[model samples]
Target: MFLEATWPLAPFVGGFCTVRHTLGVSQTPFDKFNVAYHVGDNADHVAQNRRTLDSFLPRSPIWLNQVHGGRVVDINESNISECANNQLDADGLFTRLTNTPLAIMTADCLPILLSNEDGSEVAALHGGWRPLHKNIIKQALRFFESSPEHVSAWFGPAIGPKAFEVGLDVVEAFCNDDPNYKGAFVRHPDNEDKWLANIFTLARMQLLALGVKNIYSDDLCTVEDKTRFFSYRRDKQTGRMVSVIWRKYP
Candidate 1:
């Protein structure tokens, strides 16, 4: 139903991360566990699915509108109720409060979870190429209030480099920003200007450069795993899967 990632660095860094697949009661296309309300999934079905998700979580998760931008809001007691009714317009969420889960929805895009060594701070990011180009990860990192060396990150399911074909503009977006990023793209054999962009590699490079020494990726490609995930690039109108993270109380 869901995959979980546990933090082993410290007991105080107490939180668990998980991402759901299309393995629930949701109908076809959404199949099951479709959490996004904007994707035209039935409101009742989506609501019920969320309730099921809430049952597993200590507190309700903070859902975002996810405009593919870099803004990250800190979840607080007040924001939780507001987010339940109306989602926040941001690509990332971070919180220091315990039992407050932060969630990011994705389909072919990356869902990233971050935590500090002491388990005092945790964050979730929706990392699309657009936001990656905009430095959303860096934006999210700023809220950690800790040095990058003390932070650990986990990359969730996304379109793999081999399957994610792109135009020269996509290649240029990162390469133009930094020449070192050229390694993240490979020119397609059939098309001189076309390239295959590696989302995971790019994300790792960004995290490493930011001084984050501990980084991990699930290496699950949503585009290739039809049975487990929803890929907008693969299904076009498919529903989204969510990656959630939160710090538990000591």
Candidate 2:
């Protein structure tokens, strides 16, 4: 849907595109569209899914080995030799070059896409609570050589605030770093010390702090919509969805 909206057989496939979803061969939840070999899915299915996804985009979606950390990597320096069967030490990727699609796979984690005012460069980041708490946005904001005001972002589907429950330690972790984090957390109804976090709300806070106000949010809750998206929080075992963005080749 993103590609169809962006480029439609424009100047041949010289730019980049992104895809998300874990691949599995006839697996219950991961029946198809799994792009990564991780998450206990069938490896061959993932490879085949990659081939199927190729038809929709100009370049292969550069995937990440997400570790729920704030580590962001420049695409030029990415260690492509690495495999993603296990936890990846990094969670975000950026690229200023064309034909390099930035993508992240997520079930419940937020998928973030960034673009400069001129649309010269693009990046994608996976933001679970861990990555958000770790300040991945701060890193991404720093990595952009362009002015912060010129940067625009799109927030994809994720586990909404109503669905996310966290312990006091989680709240304390954010507070310890900056008191501004407190605004993102709200007391959970059933649990005294627990909190219900709104990732969208927190993300806006973070982006505003980064000085990027042009933001678009899908407001889709993956956990709530089983048919359109995959949700890890709603179901422990599930497939992931790919969210991506990139510039076109002139």
Candidate 3:
């Protein structure tokens, strides 16, 4: 099933995050609704699941070969065919085309969806800590024809602060970018060298700093909710959930 994103986007824009439910074809650790073919799930099952998902979408989604970097591909009519044939190696995708859903697959990493106020442009980002530290949101924002103020962002489920622990290096990397980022990390209760990172807070801070005002979140923690999500940190071998957004065709 889907966890529909309820933001104030134009009626023509659609966005949602997929959940691992009993209705899917994947089995065992994947156990129903695993969408990524790179995750070692059966090819046929993944294909079937994608087909099932496609039935709900206007057109087949443009998936990426996410590398957890800041690269974002422009998905438009001219490059649409090439994009479908070659899963671009990038962490984000942007497109203004109608019904061309852009998807990002993740287990614990955040899935961030964006759209302009009038629903003319939409983007999907694979927001892992590496890409976030690299300011992937900032890169993705550049694709919007409008300024940051006119863009709204929807944050899908990811590893929450309480469950996402990191090292001093990670904290320093973010804080080095901006001392304000220090506020997003706190010393782990039992380990002085470790910190509990608030990815949601960090991403929100980045978006706000970039001048994006209308931000929304599902507030669901993938690590904590095993029934509805897949968490790589929690389960070493697991399936990936997808978050997608598109401008509906008239």
Which predicted model would earn the best lDDT? Answer: 3
lDDT of 2 by residue, 115-168 (tens): 776666567888888898888988987778888888877777889988988888
**Global Cα RMSD, each model:** 2.1, 4.2, 1.0
lDDT of 1 by residue, 1-250 (tens): 4766644643554333334453456687887778888888898988888888888888778888899888888777776677767887899998888878888889898888899887788989988898888898899888888999999988888999878989988888898899999999888988887899999998998999999989876688998888778889988887888888878754
Candidate 3, 94-154: lDDT as tens digits: 9989889999999999999999888898899999999999889999998898999999999
Q: What is the lDDT of residue 45 in candidate 3?
A: 95
Predicted structure with the largest TM-score when compared to the true one: 3
Please list the residue runs of candidate 2 whose C-alpha ends up more than 4 Å from where it truly belongs after superposition: 1-26, 77-88
TM-score of each: 0.92, 0.84, 0.97
Candidate 2 pairs with clashing backbones:
20-242, 22-34, 23-34, 65-88
TM-score computed on alpha carbons, candidate 1: 0.92
Task: After superposing candidate 3 on the true structure, give the runs of residues whose Cα lies further than 4 Å from its correct spot.
Answer: none
Worst 10-residue lDDT window, candidate 3: 1-10
